[model samples]
Target: MATDSIGNVELTDSTPTDATAFLIEPPRKRTKTTSGRRSRTNFEMLAWLFMRLSGIVLVFLVLGHLIIQLVLDGGVSKISFAFVAGRWASPFWQAWDLLMLWLAMLHGANGMRTVINDYAERPGTRFWLKVLLVAATVFTVLLGTLVIFTFDPNIS
Candidate 1:
């Protein structure tokens, strides 16, 4: 028992269970206010759609490519620098390779971006991870395009 400066009576430690109940309890959940503007747009919807579309196209492109490369004729042993040169001389193979490269790269980059967004919790961490991902994707795309377009057979 205690008394304030005004001499009002007060109780101390009278309800020990109440005090202990709070000590062992979990915190209350936070409620976000939805009365404001809309939340940020979910880019995941586009990414999910892209994955499905790209996967279907890639299946066709990759299967056709493999059949032509492996099942048509002499297969791996028949492939050489001359074979590559002959193939690249045609616009058909060049276009096929270009499409495969672009689609696969875009699909893989978008997948990795989703992964980064899911795992990287911190703002700085997510930003830097996406930055690195973009850098790698750009470098690979550019280098692959250059190689596909400028492959020289006459080089010694």
Candidate 2:
């Protein structure tokens, strides 16, 4: 080993090594320099976990909703405003719908955010896309929640 001008000890390969070995670059040494940015949090890990859990719950919720609203009794034809009113009148159904609405909206918004983050090349474009996604999600969730809670069957 010989000391180079930069103080790095260079290893002289005296042996006739394979030609391919010379083509590979040495691994870079990492320096402990701070860029003044905060360290990464576990937000990505938590989001991944939430996506999985919410997906499982959404499957059950969506399946139950489809079965109850489409397969039971006389099918879609039987579903009217009165039918919806009656279903909403029950606390259990109300809770179920509320949960489904919230979960679906949140899950979809998160998925769209991920897509936008992955595909949007420009920082400004990504920001605006996420903002639009959040706005739509909030509006839909609020409107659905209000309708579910304040539904009245007496409207003639």
Candidate 3:
């Protein structure tokens, strides 16, 4: 039992059933590392790094997009099909839009993966959710890329 700012509360200890849930000890006490699990943590580290870097880039890319589309020129009223066609005609704008699309989609997928990992309790549910997330992400990215690249200015 414990009493704090909230009120009386039961303090119970929790032990994880997963085999990988173990306290870190001194290097001398450490056991042999599993070969099968190599680089799993590395992937997580890369994902974390990607999130931070992508977020920074997204801020600039998104702000620039907004500034160009809504703040500069004739403002939102200037946005039209012809304007978009003219914009996409440039390779520079195509590359910028493509990079933004890929980054935003991947960033959102990674965030959702983190959420599914933290909140979902069942392993099966989590696996399926992640599978669905990947499928949706891939589908969206492919479709968006295709649309961006294949857009025809002459379509009436």
Off by over 4 Å in 3: 1-41
TM per prediction:
0.72, 0.75, 0.73
> How well is each residue in 35-123 modelled by candidate 3, as lDDT tens digits?
44465458888999999999999999989999999989989999999999999999999999999999999999999999999999777
lDDT by candidate, in order shown: 0.86, 0.87, 0.90
Question: Which stretches of model 2 miss by more than 4 angstroms?
Answer: 1-36
TM-score of 1: 0.72
Q: TM-score-based ranking, best first? A: 2, 3, 1
Q: State which candidate has the highest TM-score.
A: 2
In model 2, how large is the Cα lDDT of residue 74? 82
The better candidate by lDDT, 2 or 3, is 3
1 or 2, greater by lDDT: 2
* Whole-model lDDT, model 3: 0.90
Ten-residue region with minimum lDDT total, candidate 2? 27-36
Off by over 4 Å in 1: 1-44
Total clashing residue pairs per candidate? 0, 0, 0
